[model samples]
Target: MTTRTSRRAGGRQARQALRAAPLAKETRPVRAGLEGGAYKPLTQAGMERIHQAALDALEQIGLADAPQSGIEIMTRAGAILGDDGRLRFPRALVEDMLAKAAKNITLHGRDPQHDMNLSGTRVHYGTAGAAVHMVDVDGREYRDSTVQDLHDAARIADQLDNIHFLQRPMVCRDIPDNRDMDLNSIYACVAGTTKHIGTSFTEPDFVDDGIELLHMMAGGEDKWRARPFVSNSNCFVVPPMKFATESCEVMEKVIAAGMPVLLLSAGMSTATAPPTLAGTIVQAVAECLAGVVYVNAIKPGHPAIFGTWPFVVDLRSGAMSGGSGEQALLAAGCSQMHQFYGLPGGAASGFSDAKLPDMQAGWEQMCSNVMAGLSGLNMVYEAAGMHASLLGFCHESLILGDDIIGQALRCVRGIEVTEDAVDLDLMRSVCLGGPGHYLGEDQTLSLMQTEYVYPTLGDRTSPKEWAEVGKPDLVQAAKTRKETILAETSRAHLDPIVDQAIRARFNIHLPR
Candidate 1:
């Protein structure tokens, strides 16, 4: 009688327990700020050797084309202006600047929830590039990427759980004027997503105008300065150790205006940089070190990302092989170098060597993505939807890439060997006395959502079940997801008054 009563009461007790089992947080299975650094392509001695080489290069070879203002600033910061017009950083100067640089930085999102804490080996992967063409998957053709295409990409990226931030991924070909293009690009990105945005200015004067626009959106100059939602992707140096003078000016203005800057030093192997990977690394590092000295000379401890992006190319065809094994190693190697300096840094990864999102694209996209994460790249750019050696963007591919990055981040998360996680009780409950299967066990049910990651669109059904589901096309599925996301009102929508004021002031290209 007692046993029967207990069983009857068991239903009520289980119902209460089910109601009390907390639901999962809205956070994605694979999330931003996951710790990486598991894979080290370079040994300790190797990293140190590269370090000295970079230092020696900065001290001996130096860099050329410093604007007069830059020359003054660097000279003030103990960097010697050599007789050859090269700005030579003494080893002491670079080390001093490194010590003065900001370590952890917050890449703010308008929605505070989306801000990125960039410190140490914690990793975040997102999209970025200057692709000019859009791959029309259905039509099987390439066309100029318009302002509309760019806005659409940001909106889609905003909804992807694994995509952490929005970096201006494509050039707005429809807008012709330089100033107009700069303002519109920033506007389109801010209007689309509240996530931390990365954009570029054509020249230094453009930065002043862009900052004014940001002031309007931020309600005042102080507010904008207090929390800069966007960063300037300034390519301060040309390859092989030289400054792009105008971009250096732009970097100064961006820093002065209290905005963060990604000191991007992208060098191509067998092309703009040295042919050997180690040699390429040295050049890239030396250039970015010069950038650090440049930035610190402008303002001490200002937020900056050491963007040491080194790329590999196929030596024979003279074409970029962004998806090649060499490219993956180059990116991963850069990641290790970033950790060595303890600087907040980023590198390029997740590019497709294919013209379209094919099987080749899949392999190419994953190679660097996995390596970049495992090597602990702080901010992994171009980790999704970049194609044709960074010349094209595809909305469908961007959506699909979200699933791909989810798996990569899971690898970065690695395994947790906690007491409960490695429980002998869990094994015995099923094998010894109880159910003989883990399906009905309490631990199995409890750990399901927390321990395992399930892909949203990846099919897990049996062959017959998949057939019954009408054998749905994957690309079509991605297209449907995009349509659904764009159909909704953006979660990061700006205030109506602010939106109206912006439109009234600037020539808004994206229609309401």
Candidate 2:
């Protein structure tokens, strides 16, 4: 009995020690930099105004024909329908539903073992939707992607630090069957890489397959259900319209299965809706809300992200150009609408119609990136490497995008608040004699590292020094950075048996 008692005491001591030790440090802080500075905290009055605007648009003009189920739901909820199949949503009902939606959520990645926290100060980055081009290692460009290209792209994305999510499609590849192709692509990516995945497919069975793979990686179905691999299921809403049957079915499955989905609506001004930005925005909001209502109807607390990539149709060329000032305005409005629902907003800022990485690309990317970041979208998709109006993705463009995203993240970080940051006392002491000397001061040397962000790409050296080293352009610098990163960093290895099983299932031999 005495021996057992002593053993129990020792066990208690061990447990206590374990509890005392610090938890394994999170890879990054949950909330870094300034608190709540990045977000524009909306007041109750502002929400009411936005809500009223949405209602006015719905009631005055009414929305166009949505899916049959969507029409039925709106009718049941006392939303008025016109002869033209326009829907007029009840303001009260809209407000009530919006009140119940979850504003903040953490999206799980390839590993159910880890997730990207979205609330508070935490920010996650990813590329934008559906592109058709890819750039190779030897500066060669290829269009219309294949499975092999996707695999290599996933491998490269897995090795990047700033890129935290896989947005699918190195290029749309051909498989034996469409459903099988979707499943194989998703499986290949989740199995081969460690980053969070963002994918969208048209088939329910394909979704089920992707979800099953997520389950396997998560160790169980329940774990997978609790924190799913985040995906942005795209559904095209007919202009000034409602959801389609296929879209409704997809949204229902996602909700029923308790998976997070982003309701993406790409409304074009003048072509899809009205020519004016505000009118187009109101129309887009109604369409997005209609989607939200669908998801919420299927499951009251289903995880849904509100997204819009609205652009104006160029009157001259009839092309979908990405960098118009109107696009930025639409993005800001989308952010407001998401905020109204207390849901996370999704938008992309860095995209261009320029065919190459030139001034047009730089300006467009920078403008969009800044607008999206300032608008306070929770997840900024296409924050990197998009060109030719989002028709292409280049290796060099991606590297440049990393630097741009880092800059945007730094902007959101705002100003740091600490004794060292303020340095009131130190400044007073050093400046009391009127702009004297701080270079020789011990405090200056001690604090410089924490105060500055040393650039990985931007040139900080003198012009003379830069010229001596050949004065490389940003593209060359980006290329050099990508090469160095690929050479120096190693991809994280997965469990050997799991890896083998995945490859075997796909009937693809593992590269030696």
**Strongest candidate by TM-score:** 1
Per-candidate RMSD, Å: 3.3, 10.2
Model 1 ranges with Cα > 4 A deviation:
1-28
What is the RMSD of candidate 2? 10.2
Candidate 2 clashes: the total is 4
For residue 263, model 1's alpha carbon misses the true position, in angstroms, by: 0.7
Give one digit per residue, the lDDT tens place, for model 2 in 25-91.
3322221122222444345565566566667776676666466766676577667778876777677
lDDT of 1: 0.88
Which ranges of candidate 2 are over 4 A from the true structure? 1-50, 57-88, 110-114, 119-123, 135-142, 159-161, 174-176, 416-424, 428-435, 440-449, 483-494, 506-512
Per-prediction TM-score to the true structure, in the order listed: 0.95, 0.81
**Candidate 1 C-alpha lDDT tens digits along 123-151:** 99999999999999899789999998999
Q: How much lDDT does each candidate structure score?
A: 0.88, 0.63
